[model samples]
Target: MSLRFSLMGPVRAWRDEEEVGLGPRQQRAVLAALLLNNGIRLSNEQLIGMVWDEPTPSALMALRTYVYKIRKTLPELHLKSMDGGYTVRAEIVDDCRGEPLEGLRSAYFDAQRVRLGDYRLKVREDCLERELDVLELQKHVAAHPLRERPRALLMRALYLEGRQGEALDHFHRARALLNEELGLEPGPELREVHARILNGDLSAPRRPEQLLPDLVDFTGRAEEIAQALRTLPGTVGITGMRGSGKTALATRIGHLVKGRFPDGQIFVRGRDVAGELLRAVGVENPVGDRAALWREKARGKRFLVVVDDVQDAATVRDLATPGSAMILTSVRRMDELPGVTWLKTAGLAEREARDFFRKVLGPARVDAEPEQAGVLLERLSRLPGPIRVIGGRLSSRPHWTIGMVLQQMEREGKLAGVIPSDCVAMLAPLIAAEERLSDPERHMLMCFARQDAEVIDSQRAADLSGADPGEIEMVLESLAGVHLIEPLVLGRYRLPRFVRFYFRLRTPALTG
Candidate 1:
């Protein structure tokens, strides 16, 4: 009997005018395996092994189900079970010429449609991260030579994964093998994939800087940070003193390698926590609406987000993309966030300090001679903010040279305030603010803001706040929202220098 089959889009089997149905996955697997092999008697074990790829006690029963389905549909065809093997005894002939192997082919190919979509949508990502462990099993099964469709599907997935090199390599190898062994080129669909990879285009958007961070003038420290970032394998935390250039360095580091992120950078100030709290309570816009802004910035593509004066670890984690790079700045230590790379920014070394002073001071001297540069450098920590402020002051009053400015600074005691606006009046405002605290919460803010080091200890802070540890936790969290303080590590807090100073110097009248 010449059996007729139509196997495009959906698989259909027929003999003369009668139709046959293959009902279930295992049944389809059995029939398709037999069709692929053709005329061969497959032992029960071989059929079960091919169909399920694993041990099953009901394997024979499942095979019986497939055989029964096929038998019921093609009652005229003879199927014999003998010698513990199954054989299709039907004499299927050519349609006077080219026979129809189309039905079984369609069934087998249709099985792959959803699998291909799942591999593309549910598994692939451009972050070079293995996010879906469940797909790992699929990857192994799809790599086999006999599974051309699945293999091609997997390759297309990898191509969309931003691993252009690996994807292209697999595609080429598959193409070569398909042509050499099967005498067939990859279908037009896969051919289009080859074209796309060659053109460096894939459905998954590329992350421009996965391998390295963009380097900037940071010199030794910046390069060291970048190298640490590449090797460290996770997020980085940056800490420094006021005018120590933490924000500047963090911003520079992010900018240097912004292209690497491809996701753009996020900048949020530490002091904006109040705004964040107010927004959270629906009282006012979150400080600069940074949380909402961050969400917006992070909406579509990946990003390298920097939260300056990072007081909120929860906020940081919320804003962070799982595999993306982020640089956070704090006046305090942030040891709480996991997988954070911490880089400390101290004031410049003496030589760099001298250069900074001179950069602002210039070649010619005003009142004091050029040699008096050393005197000014020793008095100042060589911090850029202070150097610029002092230089700008002296340079403005051309009548005074370095010596005279130093002399007047020494006499008037205005040298401290002479620091740039960004880093002016450090300790006094903090101390006076401590005096004005009516509640332990306010005092806690004062203590955290005046942290001598770059980070604060929150648990110890609870002890200092004189509130229950839980209350301290709540207040600390609240202060963090207002950007008054930031978490350097769990239970520790760091205060921004400018705010600390502002509190100490400005009396209630000035502050109110």
Candidate 2:
């Protein structure tokens, strides 16, 4: 028996050079999540959280069915049934960086220069300042001997810690040194940051991308967020659809409890996941056993690795050394990651989504036309990604009212609206899902497109598609795995409203 598993792109498997039949999209998500962390056992609760974005009454039963289907399809795969969860057998080929529950690849890294802001984060404190860090900032200034950004940062750090006299004194010294050296004034941004510090705006916000944004009106996921904090020093997986605030939640938790991780907080994105972590901890150009070297270096260091926009779980698993805590955010469900807690982010509740709108548009703006606003939220699918994009557009234009926006939504239709209700953005994921389907599965989905009902069972599907009942059952299951169709209890299939609209929009000629 030969078996190959890919966690990259969409979760798929090959046995004997032929693609093995997989279950529904959620099930595929489960499979992908499992394959990524091949040796780790995931409990039923963990699997349920990663697979389903929302709480389902039948999640436990559904998980059982999905596992059984996977076993039946890939009998050669070593899918183990643990005491409380499940595990799958597959070798982790380290290469590629697709998001969670996708594909795998080995990590290669390159060195980078650490900025003052980044360095400062490694040794930051809230109420007090570390004297050695102050000296290190000074040492960087001495090395530059002419730059003002580092000097300005040093001043700000001192000022926040109630060293007003020393901060001003340092600023004056930096100003004099600059005049004597390059005959230049500090850059506008540096000057502004210094000014803000001088004005006692210590509580002023930093860049939105600076570690974590201040989520003052942070709306949902109280339980999951809390559990994530509690499970620190261990791995916590945050998986959701794109723009579901997976990264935001991870950043927030990283910042809130950073006191526990005194070593530092490493926020990684772009190339070289392992390389980036090594740089943060003072290692350069590792030549062997990257995992072992990383474990040695990170030993006794309480750094928090917040891996945003994760493309593959192999990167996370490889980076999860015996040392250090990790939090992974992905747009796909992740499974089989050993010793990792799972948190699946869904669309906000009605109340939270509405409240989020109020905060974004201001209470007066949304409250004035509450009914229309409520309807508008539903149209946006209550996903944070859409809400923030559209809300940001509206907030920037004060003259435009919520009612005006709603009218525009009706006129252009939610999916057709360019900025706020972008059909292309909403359809991208569905398109990707469709691309992963087999020829028969694609044909079956085409048949689904021709139907009127939003749901169809295996028997009804065969009737409408003119395919054999047994064949249709397998086809529907395949389509459901990529989320083109939803698999229900007793072999029923349901489609989301947006999905229904998209199918109807597809020309019959194209489907035929």
Candidate 3:
């Protein structure tokens, strides 16, 4: 059987069809350093130096002890005493490879730099086969075997090779992968290369490229924006509560449309009160001749621009122009920016909410009883944020069961805050008819509108609502059935921001 050690996440060893555990920290330490220093034999001193940040007494002995344990655990490993130190045989180290093909591609590009003619020709061939940018080739290079520098080179080569589609794809992937692996992103060199390639303005001679900001995660609304993008030279707006992923969708669309535009792509934040166009391009107070720069650099550029978190109409108006496609996302809709398509986003559907809960609550815990899944979803009103919070709490409290969660919610007086009409109007339910709340429940719902507050555990709810534990539990269950208020955790609940705002006005009599 073959032997291989995996170092992608945690370090572990395995023989063909068998598992080998990495027993101790020291063993893990030794294995980690060797993986980092692949193809290089580290002397005892060198290995010790890499492992510890602080100085230690008897470092040699610690190193030897770790090596002994590793070999003992995996008798199949071929460790040799060579050139006055220890070395792992090629076959043993081979199994510990990280990203194989990515490395080969990077090396391929490095060889291209010296022989530009041959490199360009090969890049052309790649473009034909994959329709990928030469610059993108660098990304696949950086992904595994090769390092960051070569990856940047591949991005440049692809852009130079006139493979815009592939080039932009590389930048997007590199940005994501680098962020995940290193918690950072590619430098300005790549961003500028990416920008030029997308705007179809990558000059024959690569000019100076500007630095780009880190990309944000685009969840939930990817499909919505993708559909809107099909109609070019159009406008799309994302509307939701604060922190509800509006800006994320717009930014992702910007990244997506980069290839479609060849003249230029502009990214601006609505908060930039200065009204300076250069700030949108990622520069602060861009100096020298200002008017000349704006006219020469920006005029008549066919680009895709994303203006984020638009709160003020006047500010949005100043940023608008005739050319270039625009995508905007705002907490509240604005009529100032006219002649643009609008897309409204709300809470996730039942299935989406269920999937999100399963992700947070763990498949085993959620899937154990199917009936409990329906109970949890119905109680939460299928709102993603509240569901996530509740799911997260349940996941963390492994000892707590679904019944306990529900019962706790009951005793806290968190029930019956929503009437049937509240849900039908908000969620756009499948049924043509809407449900209404009973007068007693309506009175209780009015109580919530009087105070805009967070729903704590059940004990707190009982104290606030002046309702007995059993009565509160019964009301909450009834309300949840019609999607009035959503159960947060065992005694807590949350109303959507808009829902809260709506009730606030209705509660004027109580407040007055």
Candidate 4:
């Protein structure tokens, strides 16, 4: 009862390792058609079509005669008749030993031959994807350029091997070839792989697990962290003054909720955020736009996405999906985002700042000069960025005491100078924020710095800058939007201490 059949190469059958004679070529064609459509009934007309390129007047009789012979040859095959059609039960093994129905020549068998050939190719490609044999897949793709699955496999293999550029180039070539030859575009498989490559997404058909490393010495933002966590599976926006640790808080929350999102924990920043996000989830690249593709990929996925340092709400407007959660960190409040729970970050409390210093500089050093530490923290306005910079500097220079550090701060007389040369990179964010200001914004910022008052109302700003009060309010709101200045009660605003110090040092003439 153990019967095995193969149509991959010469049509053949075996019973308990013994080869069975399947009659002559024409008869074998009938048997081959029957075996290929195993468990499916084939009428007389169907059998005639498969067996003959051109059926003669006696074709039906010949088919009946072939059927009888096949039954006699392999009686165990149980070829039966029902509803005026024949059906068979056989286990067809994919033993690709030779061409299907080798030596069987009949123009009528051409379509069947082509169909079986495609099936064999699919078997080979399945093996290639599992094996990830790049070299063999290359050859396979070259032989069958229109095969999207193998090409996608090839692209993924190339990307995983760090040959991203080459993989991307291969996609472009394939796309062009697909369009040129067939007057069509690449299928979803190819486009997805291409999108992953463009977005630098290596994990496609696999969940993306990515997040920035959590700060080992991360400090403060307890209430903010709690509020962020409470939002759960919903979008949360964390905004604050520059250097208030928005990114750090978001990173911390990403780590905290890592277990909740089994699909992924993705962190994305920089200009191509949409592309990066699509790449993270392994979405296929679309032909013209990514929004639809991104939505498709994000839908019904349990994942966490941390979009850091977002400058504009529009950039990530469509990033949220139904089943996933997202955290966005920005310098200013993004009220434009719908249903977003906002958490505004501020400078760490005195205790948290001390703890941060202890973690960075060691308790021994911090405890040694409590007074100097407090003064230094006061000078830095308890902002995490400056504290981290000064702590890192002091940690390395064990010989320098907190008093000496404070003296250095006084001597330098500017936020930029307080940071050591090697640690000057920490100030890049602050500098970049200032540099992004428009000409009028920058001039208005200088005007704000010129006034002796700590907090300036629109009227005061108008009086100082000689601009209209309405225009000054717009400019002040714009400045507040970027976190360069903090809006206070009663339509007043105060420049952050660090911003004031930075502008004072850079443009001393304006302050004078």
The sequence of per-residue lDDT tens digits that candidate 2 reaches over residues 253-364 is: 8777665555567888855778777766656687777666777777534567888877777776767754357888875556756878888775688998889988877888
Q: How accurate locally is residue 256 in candidate 3, as Cα lDDT from 0 to 100?
A: 56
**Candidate 2 residue runs with Cα over 4 Å from true position:** 1-210, 396-407, 410-490, 498-512
Model 1 C-alpha lDDT versus the unseen true structure: 0.54
**Candidate 4 structure lDDT:** 0.78
Off by over 4 Å in 3: 1-223, 242-244, 261-270, 273-277, 280-283, 286-296, 300-303, 321-323, 378-380, 411-512
What TM-score would you give candidate 1 relative to the actual structure? Answer: 0.40
Between prediction 2 and prediction 3, the one with superior TM-score is 2
> Cα deviation of 255 in candidate 1 (Å)?
1.6
Whole-model lDDT values for every prediction:
0.54, 0.64, 0.55, 0.78
**Clashing residue pairs found in predicted model 4:** 9-98, 53-108, 192-284
- Cα RMSD for candidates in order: 21.8, 19.9, 22.4, 20.6
Q: Candidate 2 local accuracy as lDDT?
A: 0.64
Off by over 4 Å in 4: 1-204, 414-423, 447-453, 509-512
Number of the top-ranking candidate, with lDDT as the measure: 4
Q: Which digits, one per residue and each the tens of the lDDT, describe model 1 over residues 1-512?
A: 22434322234556434566657655666765565345589898877766665547987887888888877866654567779888763322112111222333333344544443343332233221322222552554354564454444555667665666776777777788888988887777567777877876555422233223332333335454554344221467776555566666766666555644444444556656434422332334344556566455344344565667776666665455443456777755667787677777654676676656656666556224645776665545444555566777777777776777666554433222233342344333233434434465566644543453346566787666556888777777766643446566677766654444443333232324
Report the C-alpha lDDT of model 4 over 1-512, residue by residue, as the tens digit.
34667887788887646788787788888988888787899999888877786889899999889989888888877889887789997656565456766877777567778887877887677556546778988998999988788889998998888888888888889889989999899998888888867887566356677888999999888788777755656798988877788888999988887766666788888766778888876554645467667877766456798899887777889878865789998887888889799998777899999999899889999999999999888766678988888888887787999999878655555443244465355455567787678766777776665452467688877887788888888988998888777788757987766665555544554344
TM-score for each model: 0.40, 0.52, 0.39, 0.58
The TM-score of predicted model 4 comes to: 0.58
Residue range 198-230, candidate 3, lDDT tens digits: 677664521112213434322355457655664
